[model samples]
Target: MSRILVVEDNIGIRNVLEKTLKMKGYDVFSVGTGENAVRLFTSDIFDLVITDLRLPKMDGLEVLKKVKKISSTTIVIIMTAYGTIENAIEAMKSGAYDYILKPFSLEEIEIKVEKALSQQRISNENIILKEEIKSRFGWITGKSQKAQKVYKFIKKVSDRPTPVLILGESGTGKELVAREIHENSSRRNFPFVAVNCAALAEGVLESELFGHERGAFTGAHAQKKGRFEIADKGTLFLDEIGDLPLNTQVKLLRFLQEKSFERVGGTNTLKVDARIIAATNKDLKEAIKNKSFREDLFYRLNVITMTLPPLRERREDIPELIDHFWSRYTKELHKDMAITPEVKDILYSYDWPGNIRELENAIERIIVLSEDKVVSIDDLPMELREGISDIIPKALPDNIGFTERVEYFERDIIKQALEKCSYNQIKTSERLKLNRGTLQYKMKKYNLYCKKISTKS
Candidate 1:
């Protein structure tokens, strides 16, 4: 239920407000003085505060300021006369939601209360959405040395508003890192607008970047604000930047140099303070050599270059990545699924040329189609299972029970991880998401070093 606090010095007016709001299904609390209203507010939470402009000891404006200081999100409504209407405006400037005149009807006050609560609801929802964005895209999860370096660089450059050029293979999460940078940066509360430079046509691309003036073209009947202007005081992410046309590249170079640009077919030059973050899969230097991309723009964007390693190069992080995707998709798909040890081995062995994106999609697909609790080799894509059918040999003893069988599989998974890390115990433990002492104990129990590792790279 929405709670409202009514602060009126007139006892008759206070009783009428309290009775009317309560009849309207609001939990209304009435007080005769602003001091009592503030005291009650400090003790309990109220969604809306309706206060009289004139009060004894402390004024309604004072109560509004004190309540705002305690909770900036609290909604405050000022009630005043025409003579003191200016004071109500000043109270609103100090964060009062709205004002109700002294001769206001019950319906008028009800409408004001409803509007204030509605706005407050929207404000609360936005807070939740922002927190969700921070929770989902704020962290870059990996323990590999390469991933650690990316973390350090994100933290290092988050405070500065410099151009960041991210170079990586497709699906290597260049945009994810860009979001990480924005979410951790000082401008996190502002917008993080992204545009695909390669997706739009050359004609549309210019307008998309710098906007178009009214009557600029046949279809452009209205003025449109571009990504740069929309992302002012925030971050603008330009994806697939290597595919930009030469004409657009020239205009982009000018924007980078001058931090200003004129609308297409418009003479007025506009400046926007948008921090630029560009990402691409193509070899930009090669494109420059071929006269496809501009070298000057390249140098401007390369001021802070962050290169993301492909999944194949960061092999040790695969298992944890699989877990990350698996956990996410299973919950989203509402599937009680468990990946088999054999499937994990196959996934860890496959070379993900498409990088993290491919692996993430594969996990989601498996969970979607899977009906049983256990995700076996048959649940995976055919290409993922091919050329690796003979991955783990069929050496489990036929007499072994389920408990012994689980033990046998666990040992092999540990052994495979150990071999991948060149038998480095610390690296193996980290790759397997285990502590060094626990891994050592398991290795000893499984007699991993008793027999030589097989000839498997």
Candidate 2:
């Protein structure tokens, strides 16, 4: 149920509002002064506040500001007489939800109250949804102190319209950070366009950025709008900015300065408003020294910089990351799988050079290959196996039976073939020159037969 506080200096009006709202199923409290309303607010939480514009001790605008300070999400409606309508407007400017004339009917009050409550409900749902999304992202990215700092910095600069340069190694989620900034910004409703600068040649990259007119090139058949034009009033993420060609760099600098650019072979200088976010794994300063990347362009793009630390530096997050990826893959593959402590030990010890992407791949592989519920150390890849071998005993004791040794050998071969073929039994058996049924039998014997690979990508 919604709780409402009604503040009116007139005793009769306050009693009437309190009785009317109470009849409408709202827990209503009435106070004749803003000071008492504030005192009541301190003692109890309220969803809505209805206050008169002119009060005895404190005015409605002051009450509105004070209520917002106490709880910014609380809905406030200002009640004003004919002469005090201007004061009600001022209250609205100070964060009042809506203004109701003093002589309004019960029906008008009910409508305004219902609408305000609906808006508050919608706002609360949005906040909850955003928190869920942030929590999921935090789980996947490993919320280490370094990661938290990066998140804090992103929040600090998300609303600014300055250029942001993100530096991180490959697979360090630079583009993810860029998208996060865009999603949190004022222009989130606009499109977000991303272009891989290293993936295109000079001419193609230029055409992609600034568009081209019909007959501009050999294969040009129709006019085209480039990323800048497409991303107008939005954000354009340029990944691997260090690899951008010198000529394209000069053109980009001009566009950033003037917010305008001419299409290839077109005389018209089209203007657009676009926020540019650039990412690079290369040291751009060193590239400047090598005369490959332009210094002026670098400075123009480097107004705001954020760097992502490699995963090795945040090893403290490894266990949580492992659990996160394990749960994800298990859900995706529709399998009930668990990782053994020995496997976790090896995973924690090994340095993840490919970072989160690599760790996710490793988890997916384990999920796709492990038939039984538990993932053992034998299910790991060769590099991890070798790394684990160094920390444990290498030779088998003589007391161990031949059957156990054969089981270990069979498990190792199955894991190797699965790794090679990416857990496709047909391919693995074909490469092993064994019958598919025989391979399945062996895999079952060693508990390596995971769920069949889904045909859907």
Candidate 3:
């Protein structure tokens, strides 16, 4: 149930508010002073706070400020008497959700509280959705040496104003890296705008980047701020930068060099302080060799470069990635399922040609389509199960050294499991019947870092 705290100096008002809120099926806590209200807020998880504007010793505005400091997400509603309109408005400015005037009907307060709680619920849901979307990328799921190296690189360059170019294969989480850089950087407070160069045609891409003045093109009816302008004092991410046309590249290069540009068919030059972050699945050197990409532009963006390793290389991270996905999707899909050892063996044995993205899709498919809570071999797609058998040889030579062969097999199996789970140690240990400490030791011994699992272009 939603928790609401009622803070009023008057005993009668506090009792009435608490009783009314309790009748509405909310968990209510009542306090007779602002100090006691703050104490309750710190001691418990409250969804909403109703405070009287004129409290003895401390006022509602102070309570709102303190509550915000404690939990920025908590909603605060101010209660004031009819001639205290100025104080109520001041409360709103100080982060109050809404104000209730004295002599208010219980029904009116109920409706207001309901609306405030509903809004808070929506806000919380949005935060969860964003975290879910962010976690879908493989780069966010590991602490392996390779992942740590990449993390350190991101941290080092995130503060710099230089352009960053992330090179990674499809589904290798280039965007995730871009976001991490932005989030850790000084520009984090501002918008982190993203554009896909390969997704848009040259003409449209040009307009999208530089925007256009009114009547600049057939459909340009009014002035439009480009991505750079919209992302001023923030980070602008250009995905698939290798596909940008030469003409657009020239324009982009100029923007990078001068930090200013003119809109299409417009004379006024606008300056933007947006940090540039670009990503591409294609090799820029090859693109430059083919004369498809400009050398100067490549050099500009490559100031700080980070490459993501493919899933095949970092097979050790799969098990962790899979477990992370399972934990997330189990809650999302409302299923309490466990991945079986046999199924894990199958996953580790197979070669993931499609990488981390493909593995996540396969897991989601099993979670949704499986009839039982336990995901067995039968739950997997036929191709994956078949591929596993083909990849693991059916016979072993008697002449071969047993210890050496077993060690090799164990290493390979562990590597694949890690890759399947996305380098999550808890999941990897669960899959391998080992503790987290043992798994960490084995990963170190094998020289396996999570970054090896997903290929960065």
lDDT, candidate 1, equals 0.87
Reference-based lDDT, residue 412, model 1? 77
**lDDT of every predicted structure (CA atoms):** 0.87, 0.86, 0.87
The local lDDT score (0 to 100) that residue 176 gets in candidate 2 is 79
Off by over 4 Å in 3: 1-103, 390-457
Supply candidate 2's per-residue lDDT for 212. Answer: 99
Give each model's clash number. Answer: 0, 0, 38
lDDT of 1 by residue, 149-262 (tens): 888998999888789999988888887888888988988888999999989999999899889999999999899998899999899999999988999888888888899999
lDDT string for model 3 (368-402, tens) is 99989788777899888777553353556778898
Per-model TM values vs. the true structure? 0.64, 0.57, 0.68
Better of 1 and 2 by TM-score: 1
lDDT of 3 at 334: 91
Residue 216: error of model 3 in Å?
Answer: 0.8
Ten-residue region with minimum lDDT total, candidate 3: 387-396
